[model samples]
Structures are given as structure tokens and as C-alpha cells.
Target: MRLNRGLPAVASSLLLALPLALAGCTSFGEGSEEPAAASATPTEVEAAPIEWSDCDAQIQPLIEGQPGSERDLLFECGRTEVPISYDEPAGATLPLFLVRATPAGQTERIGSLVVNPGGPGGSGADAAIGLALTLPQDVLGRFDIVGFDPRGVGLSTPVDCIPAELKDRVIASEPRPTTAEQLDDVFALSREMADGCAEEYGDALGTFNTVDTARDMEQLRKSLGDEQLTYLGYSYGTTLGSTYAELFPDRVRAMVLDAAVDPDTDVVADAEASAAGFEAGFDAFAENCKGLIAGCPLGDDPRRFLEELLAQAGGAPVPSSEEGETRQATPGVVLTAVQAALYDTASWPQLAQGLRAARDGDAKALFSLADELTGRLEDNSYSNLLDANLAVNCADTDEVVEETEVRRLVAEWSQAYPLFGAGSAAGLFTCSVWDAERTPVPERDAAGSAPILVVGNQGDPVTPLPGAVDMAEDLESGVLLTWQGQGHTAYPKTDCITAAVNAYLIDLVAPQDGLTCPA
Candidate 1:
């Protein structure tokens, strides 16, 4: 239930399956160069144009039907048409959805604090609604939060590369091929998927990448008339913040990049690191399960329980109690389900209860959990923004290994992490075949006046600790903040982290060079 108590049985490499789309591309310069400063002029921030008639006619009815806190949250609907290519400046137009939420007081407006939740597919509008509830009160009061569905994501001009059946088949694919033939099929499938994207989407896919999104951010800044940008990016969003800082270094007033990803690493590197991180997380989960009987399903030997579970899942899935549905509860599905629950500790108890039920031959609980894991839930327990994620990743990754290479890697990783390596390797199948143009890595130089904060989680099963440490060393003004805990992304969860990040954002106070917090 509590997967982060030790480490995930699977490698965290699947995180890279989404690819590291956060932050600026190499175009920003190398690590040694000083980043340029933002314009200093204080200009009145302009409100985005809202079509009140359009809102009443089209958007209001949709909002009225929604029930709960989202209903109470103020809604401003608007659209911005950006060029398909930033370089072209006046190319084909794409409409982007913009959602704005003003803070309680008008006097404390800190301009628009652009927040991205980082699924590359996560709807910014949805994130804004949830963020309004979870954000630290002090931070919320000071900034007017703006969440936008990035191009080719959410309300934006989204991608429809895979048909519904193909998408379903792809998500439910076996963790790894059992034979050489299967691997070949996967390779062909991956290539086909990527090719489909390119063929279906064409040049429009190129604009969805992070570099272009950063340009979109700049456009947003221009539209708002703000000389500087403030941002809070989570998970993959950290990459976006980093990208923004890289492109418009002078314009970044303050940024909180939670669950940081190293800009220097490609998807391949990210895949390897993520795999290892999840293994570490599974270990933590096992350790926690050992002592807590009521909260954990595994009786006495946690490792043994996991081993048996994996074996059972891999062999043949059992029927679920819920609606008598027959589903393949493969180790991959189980691990993916468990991993999703680990994101927030709030879901731990539910997982524990489900596992307890699973131990009783009621696979329904696990199946339900898996459903939530895959974004079948209405609350968006999973990151449903795969279209944009694919666009960014397909563009960023210059090369994807063939099926043979993937199989070899899987075998190697399996040797390294016996329980979850295959699943991690399998997740990469999607990225390897994503369609788009391959470009050289951009030059990213972080040297500057203000210190850029890099947060790391010690037992993170996604973005490992080494990444933060390495990025800190790479950046000229990088400061490392280590959260000696488990899971991905630390800020807003820990008081110490929140205090540090809040201080940095509010007063431009960077924490000490190497700051670590213990659980």
C-alpha cells in the first residue's frame, strides 16, 4: 500500500517513457555561460481578452453542470492563437485554452503565476482547480494563478495519433515480449505509432515540444504585459520552468520547480535513472509493509510477498470480484497501479485496504486501483495528457533504440532489478517510435546572478537524487535542496521544503547550497 517505504519493485525509468520535456532545450546555451536577465521595467499587467458572449453561449453551460469546489472556483475562458512555428513567427495558427484564477485580494497580485502540473497531458485548467485547494495559503494570496492547456494538450489543439482501440491495446500491452517475435512486433508497433503521429499531425507536432511551449510562455508574458514570469511547475512541469528560465533568464522573477529533471540528460538517460529510482521506492514500500500488518497485505516477509505477487501476476491474472470482470492483473499493471497511488500519501490507506482485499482473492480492488492508475477515474488520478507528452518527447529524443536493443536492455535491467525491470523497459516502447523531427540537444548554461534551486528526493522512484545533485553542480547558480524522503516532488508536502520554496519565491531567498531534510 505504502510503496515509498523502501523502493518500487519496478525501475522508475517509466517516468522517462513520458520523456523529460520540462525546462529549456539546449538552445539556451551551455552550463558554463551566464543566463541573460529579464527586462526590469514594471508595466501594468493586462487582463487576457475574454469573450463574455462566447463564455455565456458555450463555456458557462459546461461549468454549470459540474458539482463541488470546481463550481465555486471562478472561471475565465479565453483563447490565444499562436503560430505553429515560433521561428516562422507568422505561420499557421493554433488555438490554446487559457484559464485564469485571480487570488483573493487584488492588491497582492504578483502578476500571473503560470502553473503547470506536468503530464505533458495534464490539463492546466484542471490543475488550476485542484491547485487552488492544495496550494499554501500564503503563496496563493500573492499570485494570480494561470493554468493553460499547452498546445496539442487538453483544451488546446490536441493530438489524435492513435485510435481508441489502438490506444487501449497499447496501454494494456504485456510488460515485455516473452519471445523474439513479440519483441519484433513491439518494435514494429512502436515505429508505426511514431510514424502515425508524424503522418497524422505533421508540422503541428513540432510546435508542441517544450521549446515552443516556452515561447508560448513568453507570448503569455507579452499578453499579460509582465516583464518577469513567476512559475510553479510540478513533476514534468519542472522541466517547463527550467526551459522558461533558460530561454528568458532575465524575465524569471522566481520559480519553484518541484520534482526536478536534469535538462542535460536525454530520454535514454532518464529511462535508466527512472528505472533504478522505482526499484529503490519498492524497497522502501517493502520495508514499511514489514512492520505494519494492518496497513500492509504481505504478512511477515515483504520481499517474499512481492515475489509471489509478481509471479502470480505474471503467470495468469485472476478474476476480479467487482462486476465479475476478467482482467489481466499482470505485474506491470500491479506495479503501475501501485506507483500511481504512491504519488500522494493520501491514497496509501486506500491502497493498503485494497491490497488486503487482494490477498483475499478479491482482485477487484487491484483492478480498480489499476483503473485509477491509468486515468479511468474522473478525478484524474492519472496524467491523461499523453498526446502533448508524445509530441514533446518524440521531438526531443533524437534516437530511439530498436526492439532488439530494448530487449537487451530489459534483460540487463531484469538482472539488475528482478521484479520490475521488464515493465520499465516496456514503457519505453512508446517513445522509441514517436514521430517527429530529430534535432541536436540545445546549449543550456545556468550561470547567473540569482541562485536556481534544485530539489531532490532521496528515495524518489522517479527523478532520483543524483539528478538534482548533478544539475546543481552543472548550473553556475544551482543550489541543491535534498528532501530525505521517498516519492517524487517534495515541495508543498514538507513544511521545511515549503518554507524554503516560499521564502525563495516571496523574498528571493535561496536556501543554503546543500540543504537536506530528513523524514
Candidate 2:
């Protein structure tokens, strides 16, 4: 339910999305210079190797496993201060935390592979650890796997704009506000979130946009001592990476963007597309459930069960069964849990279990899923995920769809996409109330960049297939690789996708354009 303006972060393969309050306004804060340099070449800088330290402490909190277990590569953590607004490189700066999983034993070097796991708010530091453990040996052998928390995310002096209480209200708010009273509440909440974040962050809120993040990438490249940038971006990471290619196309040696975000879609368009995607993904989940033997947790009709639960939850939240758990499975929370499952088919079975539990009057499973997707912490505190998600999403776009327009879309889309559209249409208002300075994400051709590989999964619920298609079409040298697979991203899933991506990152060889791999 986090009505973000841009695409949500990935949770399973690193993207997570939820309903969170977000807004936009203008101006770089005091001591600001100008926005990031858009010229293809980076500013003159001497090579400065990253100062590394033990990262096990920072990375352990985000993953599962015994403490300090020996692994292929011990992660080394570090940070570099980058301008809060590139317009003022020496002005107020934020520490961009980085984690490097030094390859176990190197063969031939292909430079560092800078990886971003899609959150515009997701933790690249965490992704580096996970990928270090699981990325193909071939990729590891040829490159140093490095990931950084984009400014205002995770360890990067995260954006903590909204108060904890307000964030809870935002999460628990209605998913589909039908009546005038309900709709008004939505607007009021939007205003509250926007005003609060603006008051809290001031002009610095405007600096969290993607273009600036791309500029930060350039700074990171120079700091890493790489002559050229090699990158692997997933989901929204594709957006950031593409912006990098567009800005510093010549600085790029190679890039692989999986589960691409369309460079051209606006807030409303993205929400509508999300509705259609989730609906399709749900259908697939339902169809798969039908094929299971006697153990299909969802009985005869999955959609009906979901609708009934949602309708019931709108009036009274379902109670969770976990011994000390207090969070109720309200319609917004319930829908978020369902949407979370749609990200990966691997989660569908768990989704079924959660639904069955809800039907049986014990909804902790559903509540837990929602908690995870929204980055709710075990201590009942939330991560800065939603706050940063809002800041970046709102900062990236300049569009301002009015309340009336959002109402119209909700009315039309609800009937068109029964389960997901109505609520998602409300996302359009997320940025409308925002008063922050906006830097619109540019449509890119990435002219003169090295061949960039763009991969798409047919069943990705968050960033749909068309985003990849549009991304490939948008890049001058982009090559398209399609996977008839199910999940939020297509990478290291099947041998075909892995080999192609590895080859590209390793040898700068791209799979044939329009290449398709069977699921």
C-alpha cells in the first residue's frame, strides 16, 4: 500500500513495497551549488581506494545465518561522503555506505561489478552480502562485487522524515477509499505525510532523486579506482543504472538490468500497470493452486476467498494468532501481504498458507508477510525504508495529479482490475501533495554507452514486462533478453539468464537482442 510515485523496491531478490506516506516540493538546501553535472565525463578526481573495514556486523542484521561463519568472500565495508546535492559537491554531504565482497580467488579481472538491488530504498549493502554468497562463481571470479546504499537509504544517513506513529497510520490506512469521507481521509493523510516530511527534511528532501544517485555512482566509480563502470541493476535499480548510462554513457563498460523499470512512465501510469500486473500474477497463482493435489490451501476459488477476506477486513481487521503479536490484518495490510507474495512464485505457497490461516481466523501469517514487505522491524520500529522510499519516489517525479483525477481513476480502474486497481490508483495522490523540488526522471537513449543488457520476467508483479521492453527500446545500445519465468526479477534463476548476464558482465558479450528463454 505504500503509494510511492516510482516503482517499489524488491524484497525477495531485494525489492520491497508497501503503502507508505510520501510527498514532494522544491529547492536544494543552504550551501547548494547546482544539480549533478549532466555532462558525460566525471569531475576531475584522483583515484582513492575505498577504506575498508569488517562489515560482518552491519550485514549480519539483514540476513539469516550464524554469526561470523566462514564464507567464500569476507565482506569489507566502507563509506565515501558524496554531496547531498551534487550542485554543491563540497556542501552538506551524506555518507554512502558500501560493502565489498572480495572474490575468493581471482582469475582474470573485469573491474568491479557495482550492484543495486532495486529499492531506490532497498539496501545495496545487504544485497552485496547475499549476492556475494550466491552470485555465479564466474561473476565472482572476474569481478569484485560491490554494492552501496544510495544516499538516504539504509546506512547512508537514511531519510527519517515521518514519525513512527504516522507511518503506522499510513500503513494501516484504507487501501480502497470509496466514499467521499473515505477519500477525504486519504487526502488528509497524504497532506499530513507531505507536510510532515517537508517540515522535517526541509530543502534536502529534493536532493534524493535518481539523477543525483547516478551522479553518486560516478563518484563511487572514481573512489573504487575503476577506469570504467560495470553494473548490475535489478528492478528500480534499472532506473538508476539507466540514468547513469544516460549521464555518463562513456564511463560505462557494461551493465545488466534485470526486471527493468520503464524510463518513461509516470506515477499514475505506473500504478495502473501495477494493478494489471498483480491481477495477472494472482491469476497465475490461482491457476497453479488448482493444479495441486488435495492439499490446495485455497479451496475452490482463490479470488473469491481473497475478496471476501478483504471486504470483511474493511469493516474489522482480522486478528493475528502469534502469541504476542498485536498488528491486525486490515484490508490495506492484507492486500500488501498478497501483493508481496506475487513478487515471486516461490512465495505463493506461503501466501496460500497465510490465506488459509486468515480464513481459519488466525491471520498471523498474513500479518507477518505484510510486516516483512513494509520493513517493519522486530522491535516494532520501522526501518527508514518507507521514509526513504517516499523521499526518492516523490523527488524523482514532477507530476501532480489532483484529487479529482485520482478519484476518477480509482473508480474506473477498480472495476477494470477488481483486486488491485482501486487501491493503486490512490498512489497518484502520493506525489500530488508533495511540495518538494522535483527532478523528473529523463527518458534515456544512453547513446555511446557500451552494450547494455536488459532482462525482463514475464511474471514480475511489481515492475511489469513492458517496462523491460520499453527500457530496451529506449536505450540506443540496449539488448533485450526475455525470461518466461515467474518472479520480481530474472537473474541467476535459470542457467540461460545467468550465463547471459555473466557473459555480459565478464566479457562484455551480450545475448542476442530479442532473445527468449523458456521458464
Candidate 3:
């Protein structure tokens, strides 16, 4: 949500199994050394054209048993090579995966409309395939909906650092470590995960930064035979879209950024803001929970109740068993469950149910919610979301806070934001000991880009509304479209927002700036 470097499980779980919120790739700062002339522009040499093929065998099952026309949708998959680092176009390359969906019955097409959901690690190719099944028919008829996995993400060659078992252990660890030894153990695990990535990836890890991914997007644009880019990005995807606008503003035809990440917030500030935001969201949920059902699970004071529960879990995790596997529901696990539910208001009821069950000494419901957030399947396999999230995030920044500073922040944040403060603070050290060199991209105004539509949700816990406000104002030609609603991004959630977005993408008609659509 905040696009912070640490807290992969919290961030990735925000849009679990939902490609609509996948993030795009982009650089956040300039390279340590001046870029070679070659890096300034892609090589003139033509990359091989994509050879699209029927992907029905692999993609169709994802939508199997679903109702309506989506069942018959067709998808084409392809891959293209881009230089791992733009500085040396003739050097080693990486494969970028693509999934394209063309209108089933339309002859005249408007152009390509690329979509990114937003995990600095989210799979764009997967998002594209999902979009093919659910996007409005008119939108489908006019433009080729494309989803691409940036380098070091799904479908593309991924950064597989920690093994499934190791990752499970890391995620299932306690969130609030009271003792110095507990804290030391947390930091040690972080170091091991980071070191494992470096060992597995080597120098290739350096190329996973957003800048390289932004350049790859440009390559994608060219390969699609599009003269101008028409793009839709959510969450961290906004980072990619904004970076592209900064680097090649003139090439953008139309772009929509929903649930934007503020370009200015540092790691510490981002975590603090995220903690505050989730606290706000939890409060909203608690308020709505009142009177909706008898004997509300969170009780009269949800905040206080949660604090007690977390404290209890911290000392001794509740025992939970699912499918013959037993695990203790630690504070981290409980926090993950709560965070995952906060993503969609519809899940609030489920959260209440889970919490009620946890209170009664049955931890299965909470464990399921935690598994959903962490991508831990029944068989104990993982989706690689957490691995890629850390790989890309750690590679993007070079800020490292000492353990003492982290502990201080945890104390500070706990005072300010009780619900998620300490838990959020615990994630501060994730990128501190990472092995990759940071290639930070400077935040830009994106001065020459065409009018870009920026959408923000009123109740998003991850990418807060203020970040969207900042992002819209920072882009030279950006316009804000506010949704007075609860949830992450606006489009496709409500008819009003969806219609406006469709109109904007199809006709290039910007919504009245600052237009507020009802939830």
C-alpha cells in the first residue's frame, strides 16, 4: 500500500488473487554512476517480434466454471527479451512475459490499453488475463487489453530467494518481539532471507529495480506497435506509470493511476502513514460492525480488544490446525489476517467471524485468513509473491536503519497508531540487510505527459487517499478523480467510477477534475 520496502506479506496480501491491483515497475532514483550513453535510449536494433500462441490450456482453467461470456474468452501469450540493464543494451537480457486479449468480435480497434494491478511484484501478465474476462465489452471491443509481468516477477524469470519452508517460518514468526533476544532473532531471519536472495540471484539482482522495469515497459510499448502509451496502473503500478511519464512524457497518450503511491515518502514515513491508515480503516470497520450483527466479535472497543488479543497472542500463540497441519496463531499471523480483511469491506464480516472463532479457542478461521494473505496454500507451496516483493523493493532503495532506531520507531509508532504500530515497525529492517545495491530513481513532476487521470479511494488502508492527492498534484498534467467510497481502487467497484474511467480511456475525455463519485 505505502510501497514501503519491508512487509512483503502485508503488501502482497492487499490484492491477493486479484490481478486488478497489480503494480507496475519503475526506477525511483538515478544510478550511482552516470548512465552510459546507451542507457539513455534503447538500442536501435529491432528486438524479435512476439510470436503469440493460444494460452487456453494454461489460462482457461483460471476461469473455469464461471458464468457468462468470459467462459469463451481467448488469450494469447508471448515473451520478449529486454536488456537486463539499459546501461548495456547489448549485454545480458531478461524475458518479459505478456498476455494479450483482443475483442472477440470487433474489427476496428482503438489501440492497446496496458493494465498493471500493483505489487512491485504483482504479475501483469496474470492481470491482463484476468482483465480479459471481466472488463466492459465496449472497452474490450475497442482496445487490446495487455498485461505484462515485469522482469523478476511472475511468468518472467523470478527472483526465488527463500524456499517455501523458510518463507513460511519467516512469515509465521511473531510480529511483536518484546525481548532483546526475540528482536535479534527477527533481524537474523531478515538477514538470512536477504543473504539468500543475493546468493541465489548474484549480480542479476541489481537489475530488478523499477527503472529497468520502466525501460522494459517502453520496450513493451514498441513491440506492441503503439506510438503512444495508453496505460492503467494501480498502487505501485502508479510508480511505474509516473516514472514512464517522467522518462518519456511525450509518448503517453492516455494513462490512469489508481491508488497512487506518494513519490516523496521515505521508508520510515511510509510505514508510519500506513500504520495510521490501517488504523483508520479498522476503526471504520468497527464502527460499521456495530449493530450489523448481534454480539459483535470485536466488542465495544475494537482497538482495545485487538491490542489485548495481539498481546495475548504475542506471549502464547493460539493453537490452529488446518488440513492435518498444525500451527500456532502468533501475533504476526493474526495481524496478517486482520490486514488481509481490511483490503475489501466485504471481508469485514469474515474477519468478525474469524475473530469470534479465535476468541473461542479455535484458530482455524484466523489461520485461513493468514494463509490467504501470505499465499500459503493447503499443500504448503507459495506463489513467489513474497520473494519477488522483497527482491524488487530491496533493490529499489538504499536506506538502512539500525536495530536501535527500528526499536525506537516501533515504540514511537505504537504510541501514535495502536492497531498496527509495533507490527509495522517490525518490518523496518527487511531491506536494511539486503544484498543488492540500490538504484534509486528521483521523484519527478512528469511535466510533458498528456493529461493523466488519478483515482483515489477514501478508505484504502494501503495506498491512502493523501498519497493519491500528492501524486495527482505532483504530475504536471495530472487530474484527480476522487471516489467517496471504501476500498482500494475505484474503477470496476462502482458503476459511476467505472463508467467515467471507461469514457476517459475510450474517448480521452478526462472526468471533471476533482469529481467525487458516490460509493
Candidate 4:
């Protein structure tokens, strides 16, 4: 079955949000918007019960015509009426769309395994179906796999303020703007985007932060009839899971936070860490490429080829030869594709092929990869993934780097992190120019909660290895599980990681905190 791949929890302004940014045959309700608002504090409001129904109308279309999809599993959909603003429990409420996928021929069912794919924008509803299709029967048989699009995401009450054309322009812009003129262009674009979101959402925009989403999880748990939450959270979903663990420590039965985001780091710190991680990932790719028989597509030095490609792409448009494709190759698109490929090692060979094609002046391969990363559809229309991405990301943090600081960081990081530095530093301005109050990532600890497993990948590009280490340290009852693997996440991918997680989630047997598995 085709999967909803992992994406970063945090995306840069120029980078765009690429959470599970795969080209799709299934048009899963991409573009739609609902007005949102809230603040103060979460109150004790009874969760509206869920009435489960067939999900075929929405989900079947997604997996039907796809090459490998076998439509054999069962999926049910439901809606939970959650207060849009928990601060006002009796006030306006929005429907939180949910999908529950039953394991193949279950033996004895345990509680639900709430899986979150982790974009502040990632669709949990999509994740539920993906996990159902991919998860092993051992873990699957014991639990009902549940996924829901949190508020401000697909098929739910969304925080969609961004115009499609504007998003296209942002993705096509240069990621690393150095010159004063280029920086000016970025600033102007940022202002226009920020003003538009503000005009659309107003103060209600602030309500789209992480804390509120955590509260939504509480309601989801109650509605699922699970006495405690059993969650499998990834990437930005880790941020949400960690936050939930803190808010309702006692309510967490078993939680596996894979590819975690350190709650303590502010925006700049997170970006810097990502920059360092991407740089390392590129180096690894380069090493692997060099060891190949042909010895790398971009020649012995891939970095130099990228530099040249960026320069040429900026001056004369590098055309995409993808059939019926009209988009030109820009620096933003090139880097976005490269960044996306680095998320998983399986895509490195594809990345090499794209670069080789680019070397031959055909940008078709690059465009294909970039389109998948940005959720740019076959017709050039986009998904609401990026919309909710910017909305929740900005709302989650108050740290906004000023132009001067950004320029300084850009100059310094450009040298510090050779490939991704300058662009990432420029991206620091995304939240700065954003028009919303912040609910900064809180200091998280699953204090009284059951031992929550915090899994980390040594070569994770987006969340990075350090974030997971920090996550384990911060949580009072957190246990660290390290995979010396090279990918975005380690979970059913390897037998070692899978067995440990299955044992922990099913039997409540916590692995030793410092257990490290070889890649």
C-alpha cells in the first residue's frame, strides 16, 4: 500500500511544509478553510461521544486506483464535536474528524493505538489508514489503530488562511536570500503572507497552537472510551504527544514518541539543529554516492554541483520535463526536494538520479521530487497541509528573529552548515513575520505518567538526534530508545525496534532507558 510518509514538524517559510508531501491519486479533500479563534485556558467540558460509521466514502477513493493498494482492511470514520476554544467550553465547537482502522483478523483487542504522523499540519486521519496498512499484525491485533486530523488540519475545522497562488510563490522563491535586494523580496513576501493570514483569521489564529491541540487529544481519548491514551507519535506529533503527557500525565497509559522534538528549544535553536542534521545527512549521501561504482552523479563533489545548480536555477529557469509540467526549477524547489529526500535513506538513490538529470539540464526529476515534498498536485494546485503548517508552527512559538539577526545568522550559518545553513537562517523569519500570538513549546515531563518511550534516530534530518535525547531527559518517566539507523524514524522498519515497541505497548514492559539498537 502507498503510505503517508513522515514530514517535519517545523518547516521554514521558504522551505514550505512538506509533511507527507507525496503526489496523490487520492484527492483527500485538499483545499478548504474554516474560521478559528480561542484563548485563556482549557476548561472541563464533556467530550461529545463518537458515532462510528463507514469510511469508504472518504478513504476508499484515496487507496482505490493506486498501484499496490488492495482495499482489504476495514476503516471506520467518526466526528467528535470539540470546543473550538476550550477556554469557552459552551461556546463554538468544531468537528474533529477521525478514522479508526481495525487490524487484520484481530485476536483480542486492547485499547486504541492513537498514531499521529506529526506535522502540526500532518493528517492523523491519513496516518491511521497508513499505519493500518503498514503496521505488523502482532501490534495491530492488540489495538484499534486510531488517527484523527487535529484541529487546523485536513477534514477537520482547519486554519486555512493561505491562498494557493501565494503558497506557490513562496515555494518558488529563493530559500537562501543573501543580497539586500533578495532579502527585500523575502521581507515583502513575508509581509504580504502575514497580512493575508491576519486578515483571514485575526486573533483566532493564536488558538491554533500546540497546547490547545493537546487538550483536543484529551477529548479524543475520552471519546475513544480508552481510560488512558496509548499513542504512537512521530515528528511534530512528538511535540503534541509530549505536551499531552505533561497536561494529563496520569491519563497516559503507554506512549511511544518517535522522532521527538525537544520542547525546550525555541524556533532558532530548532532550525539550527535541523541545519546541522541536514548537513550531516548530505555528507552521508555524498559518502554513499562516492562509494558507488560510478562514483557520484554530480562528480566527486556534490556540494559544488548543488551550488552551481542554484546559481543557474536562479538566473535562467531550469525547466521540468515532466509531462504536462509547467513549473520551473528554482533554488527553493531544488533545496526542498533535496531536504525531502534526506528524510529517508531509501530516497537517496532517487535524489542522485534527480541530480544526474539536473546535470543534464532536465529538471524533470527534481520537479517530481519537489512536487511530492510540497504537496503540489498534478494540476499545480496545492494541499492545505502547508496552510495548517504555517498556522500551527507560528502559533507554537514566540521566538521571531529580526532582519538584522536573520542576516547575521544567514552569513554565519551559511559557512557553519555548508548546504542548508543560509536557507534555514532565512527561514527563522517565518514565525517572526507571522501574525499570531504564541503558546511556546512548554517544558514537558510525563511526570506521573507511565514510562513513555522516546525513540531517536542517529541520522534523523528533521527532528535530529539531539531533540530525542533532550526529550528523554526532560520527561520524568521517559525512557530513551536509540536506533543507530539512518532515517527519519525507527519503528516497524527494523525488527529490533519493532519488537521492543510491541513488548512495551502490549505488555507494558518498558525497555531499559539507555538501550541502543544497531542500525
Off by over 4 Å in 4: 1-41, 57-61, 64-71
Q: Is candidate 2 or candidate 3 better by lDDT?
A: 2
- TM per candidate: 0.82, 0.91, 0.89, 0.91
What does the lDDT come to for candidate 4?
0.77
What is the model-wide C-alpha lDDT for candidate 1? 0.60
Per model, how many backbone clashes are there? Answer: 35, 22, 18, 2
Alpha-carbon runs more than 4 Å astray in model 3:
1-45, 67-71, 293-295
**On TM-score, who's better, 1 or 3?**
3
Q: What lDDT is obtained when candidate 2 is compared to the true structure?
A: 0.77
lDDT of 2 by residue, 368-431 (tens): 7777677786668777778788888888877889889989998999899988887788877888
Which tens-of-lDDT digit does each residue in 1-519 have in candidate 3?
123211123223222343321233222121222223224343444555665777656556555654433434667777777776577777655567788877667656888899887878777876776667667777888888898877777657666677997876776776655457777778888888988877766655676778778878888888899999999888888888888888888889999998888788888888877888888889888888876747677888776777787777877887865557677787777888888788778788888878767766677888877776655766677766677788777777778878899888877777787768876787888888887767776576888888999998888888888888988889999899988887667777788889989999989999888898887
Q: What is the lDDT of residue 321 in candidate 2?
A: 71
Q: Which segments of candidate 2 are over 4 A away from where they belong?
A: 1-49, 57-70
| Model 3: lDDT of residue 289 | 80
Indicate the worst ten consecutive residues by lDDT in candidate 3.
1-10
Put down candidate 4 lDDT per residue, 238-283, tens digits, no spaces.
Answer: 8889988888888999999998886777778888888898889888
